[model samples]
Target chain A: MSDGPAIETRGVTRVFESRKGFLFREKTRTEALKGVDLVVERGAIFGLLGPNGAGKTTFTKILSTLLLPTSGTALVLGHSVTKETAWLRPRMGLVLGGERGLYNRVSGRENLRYFADLYGVPIAERERRIGEVLERVGLTDAADRRTEEYSRGMKQKLHIARGILHRPEILFLDEPTIGLDPKSARETRKLIRSLVSDGVTIFLTTHYMFEAEELCPRIAILSRGRIVARDTLDGLRTLVGGDRTFEVEAYGFEDREIESLRHLPGVSKVASEEYGPATRLTMRVRTRETTLDDVRGLLPGHPELAVRERRTSLEDVYLDLVEEEAT
Target chain B: MAASAPAYTRARSTVASLRLAVLQFMADPQWLIPSMIAPVIFGLVSFELFRGYGPYFLIYAILGAGMMSMWGQTLYGSGWATGQDRNFGTLEPTIQSPTPYLYVVLGRVLWNVVSGLFGGLIVYAVVVGAAGQPPALANPLASIALFVFVMLTLAAIGVVFAAFYVYTRYAGFIQNIGEFAFYVGTGCMFPVVLLPFAVTPIALVFPPTWALDALRYVAIPGYTGFGWGLWGDVAGAVASTAVYLAIAGLIFRRVERQVLAKGNLSDY
Candidate 1:
């Protein structure tokens, strides 16, 4: 083990060049990572949250040595990603989601054994480790069946089993439970928690806010190739500065009614969208100056407005941070 | 720590890769059926067409079909396998493994060569059964040794072809071109002596041409020289095999670096 942060990046950037049109007519450059710096301490579940095209996958690729940064430096387990990939690759694991990573034609046990060999697990311990991982992922009964015949959730579990087969120190998981059923997703979360309890550091990325809040003590939100915010759940909630949010469900409110609500005293932000049969309106107000009773007092005499106070959640903080960066 | 950990891991990885190649080949009917049937069909057809020239012609056809089988399998088993890995999305995972990528590829090529040799033996059986006699050899040991060497030479060339296939999206086009080009250039169906005068030099550069010529010299019993003497042909095959292996190593390393730099390992 090296005496430093488990993972660190300094001003890392990646630019992808693509050409389009006939006979190479045009060249376009997309900067996927724009001079970002991040650090993950040892033995922590660090969550990275982002929307589509936010460079989360590109960052994972750079850290795993699958792609080299266009500029700057990234170190994993104290070794340079570009110059020391051979030394660094063995100590870390990477799990990318979707159904394409495993060998569909072979049995799960065979796939595990092949990866064990690739990771150079000792011959004496290969079978025991394979069995243990299979049991841990709840794939023991299905381990002998061909992977193609397994359900998507089962295959994802097998992917997780393959990632931790060598007992790597740092694991990079990108959307591990994206399409799983509720039960399977919960089980997968349990597996991740157990992995953390065993002292393995996890770098996770997901769109599930509750999953992040439950698993990660610290989280970072990325938008448009930059880290917009990094802090704990409670810390991120403080970013809104003691603003209370109220939700109103109504059927007859139009753009005029929304404009009226925006002009009310103590209200800072008003946003609305269609939800089911009613239009859902949300307004953020300074909690020290406004109360739920005061909000109802300003509503139009249209008898359909049903109002209630909403709790602050990580999703609210995430949306606030991402929406701020977009502007 | 075990003193033999490095060697043990390399051997284990090689075996694992070999197992994967064999399983994939067996599981896919598109490759298995054609690979098993073509050489035998070609061997029988050639024997029936050339029965007037004596047993030597039968030997020629068998050996020709044998080399062709090896070449075809190299393209399909090694080169096309890499393309399939990309489509299956397993290419990145394999690259991410702790084992060196070169060894995994070499193991796959080795399986193709071995499987090709097995296919060649079947072709030989068909030739002998159809002709009612086995071809005599002037130096049996030399013929056997040369046969093993040629398979290895073809494996090295296959690795080079696979490197190109791994990096490019035109893998199918390359496989088509490589299969037909080697069949003609290596004189798989006929002697290079009958090819046009200008084409012989181009044919001479490929190791398979020298390999086939060397095999013919020892196996045909009363055979006479064409371009070089027996020892010269043998030496040429050895030298070309070395050169091809070196080129394969360099190309493999270059493509590995380029793909990592470009971040296109999973691109289909």
Candidate 2:
């Protein structure tokens, strides 16, 4: 194995320019990537979590050699993305989200064969490889059907089959399960894990925090074109300093009740929302051992409130990180 | 691997691309049927209108319709292929592949020429069957040579059209206007001498004008092949083809760079 990282970036940035007016117009520039630096180790499933328009796709495009960075450099498998695209492209595969990427009028098998030929897979190996990937993605029965007849999930599976048709060392999956149903999404996740076990380094990006926590040992939270935090799940949980969130369900949540909860000794923040005749209150506190009792002590006077302690999940950590950036 | 390994690989890639292009074209009958029918209809109408002019007019109608069909297939087909790929969301992945994008695009245009030739042959069969006599060729060998050269020249121009289609939003409108312009400016339907004097320079610059004139000169009894003599017209067509091919190469490279920089390769 090589000592170098599978993928690395140093101060990568991308700026998109567009004209705004009808005739002679002013040029508007939007900085999509802000000197971002990242590294993905080989054989590791690294996840990048971000909301829409957070520059995740832009970074993926740069790494895949589909789009050039406006400045700085990115290397995939020790090859420069911009200068060595011809060398790098064959070694890396990118599967973008959405159902429209396939040739809808052709059968799934034909599409895979076309891509196999394009990637220059050995003619002798093409049929076996195509069959293997189709079966792996659980599309063998529908392989001969035209892609236009496929469901969204089936189309997504076909996308994955094409991406790995070359058997690339590094696979970049951008929101691979974006529109899949629950069962299909779970199946797709299993397929990704199997690919990783076969020693392909996966670089995944998704807005689903549970998906990331389930698949990735390490995750990076990106906000507004920048990576705000990167660490393992347990490491990120420590960012909140062992704080616990308690949910209080009640009726008629008055302003004074929320104020009282906020004034509690261990409480840091209290948020409340009303749904019809009922109200839900969330309290973020320093420690559950001391704060849970105190929260109960303060809540009993209301009589209408029921309190329960909740675990701090990765979703909470992600929202806190992104909300911090927004503020 | 041998020293010629890269060339061999490129040839294989080009062939695969051509297969895919042909398959896609065949699957879309809406595009193929109209392209084939337009030229045949034009030839039939021309033969009816000019029946008084003897067998020469029938030959003109056949060959002229064939040339016009080639232009329409090359220009409109190339542009629509790009648009369809973009709409189907396949352009990005195709561009992202390890093979050079130019081969994929040029391969598609080559197949379009092949299909256009097939369509032309159908028109020829109809005309010859209706007229009951083959058009006379003063120099059969030279006419055959010029036909090959003209097709190649037109194919190169098609490459240029493909590049513009890949890069521009107005590709459809441009293709429509371009096909009409080539039909009129190249004198596919009428002789250039009857056109305005101001239009003569524009008409002469297009290789297809010289190409059609050369074909008419050798095939018709009194036609004078652009008034440049046989060798002069042949040389002019060859030279202009080279120039157009060079321009196409440069344009393709420029547009490719712009598309990559702007991240608009798959935008519809």
Candidate 3:
């Protein structure tokens, strides 16, 4: 159907079987991806965020056709990845494992041309495109230089250039800015945005939450081979919404006095802990509704008490979600 | 980047890729020098040490150096290339491109062929030409055809070896074994006939031995004093090397399938 996503995986799983020891080793199995289902619309910048060893690379490999899923199916640009990989490979671009995704012996231009050939770029048009990509990545002058001579940021740019050489409809960029300086990282992000604007569907994976928040319209948080959450930034932000907690420092407060604050309306739970000679009271409430109104009514009774409110940010929500899942 | 254009643009790209590989070879003085120098040293040492066997010894020694050059370059260059791929993380990107895997494999093999030719020629110019017993193929065109056949067989072997290297992702372990095969099976250190006849079958399994035999037969045609009919043996070696090439291709495919199934293609 015309409605098919640019990239989709349904119940995909990958298991690695390896042997241990030297002479008398037993077989070992590692489950890298487990029943993961993902969908990215055409031209969408989809972010896949996970901790290291959380199967982000595994998922990228599967989508990029470098790997086969043990138990499920994936489609890239409407091509079935497992069954028709040869058909899918030409239209898909992949930059996996950062800067090492290059032929070090070849120059930047040569690397691009090599990929262009792999993609079946017409012979007549390859030269101009090669020049274009090199210039675009600002590696034109260094295009003739061996990749071994490239700086880390230069290598990353070359990697990006190689991935887009074929003008693929979908791109899988794994840790694209992994080792880049801040300026280069910003440049890479801008280039990624431009690629997206030109109808290129980008499937990006990174550990940088802020990058995801800035670039990806939708993100899936992965941990332990499972996707914990997949939603738009605002939608994910709402997932952790409920109560704002405040540490109310008072001129004079006792544990019994903190208990009095908890008894107020809209207060869900209250805990008091000692800091030096003072009692720090943390309260969890039930609404975005001003806790100050309740605190005002309660604090006036204790004339010496000071009231303050602390709301949970997205980072706190993410940590809490991951921690909660771990337990 | 430039404006996007039409499809079907690939031939120039493939050539460009080849050019890049060649340029890289020229720049790496370390590999370039050793790849050429080692064969010359082998040729000179063998020529000086053994002269009692007459022209047979000198001519066949040159053939041995030739086989060593081809095998050395193919194995060493390809092995180092495989290592560089692992180090640079270039494998995944190339795999993701629209190019067929076979084309990429061929591009790599072609690079090895170029390196072999350059290195072999250097050794030939030094040892055979200087000794005044330079090789002249009796059936020059036929010898060319046979040389290609033998090289393809060896290349297939290289591919199987390269695939194993890819799967293991070990740095230069495959090259070490390749270096061992060069010395023992290809008769680089000594004539293959000097190896026990019992080992002939095993040595014949390696393309370099057939390659050496074919080259010797071509280079030294008339003097079959040992009762070995030169051309007949050359034809037989060609046929068997073809068979070995087919087997190597099958092994390469099998290894590729295993690596894909295991999902360790990018392990390094």
Clash number for every model?
A: 0, 0, 17
Interface RMSD of structure candidate 1 (Å):
3.9
Which has the higher DockQ value, candidate number 2 or candidate number 3? 3
Candidate 1 lDDT over residue span A1-327, tens digit each? 556887899999999986778976799899998987898888889999998899999999899889989999999877898898777667778999688988888889999998889988878899999999999999999999989999989999999999898888889999999999999999999999999987788999997999998899999998888988888877776665434678888785767777877777767778787899888888876555676666667775758779988666778878978888899
Question: Top model by TM-score, which number?
Answer: 1
Name the candidate, 1 or 2, with the larger lDDT value.
1
What is the docking quality class of candidate 2? acceptable
Q: What is candidate 3's lDDT per residue for B1-268, written digit by digit as tens?
A: 2223224434544564466567667766777455767768766765666555664565555555666677767766655665566666665565455553334555677778767766666666766665786555566666656555555656656665666666667646646855775557665445477788777777766665665565555655663321345565565566766775566567555755566677666667
lDDT of 2 by residue, A72-147 (tens): 8899888899888777777778899597888888889999988887788888888999999999999999999989
Model with the higher DockQ, candidate 1 or 2: 1
User: Each model's TM-score?
Assistant: 0.92, 0.91, 0.85
Please list, in the order the candidates appear, how each scores on TM-score for chain B only: 0.89, 0.89, 0.76
RMSD of 1: 3.1
Pick by lDDT: 2 or 3, better one: 2
DockQ of each: 0.47, 0.43, 0.49
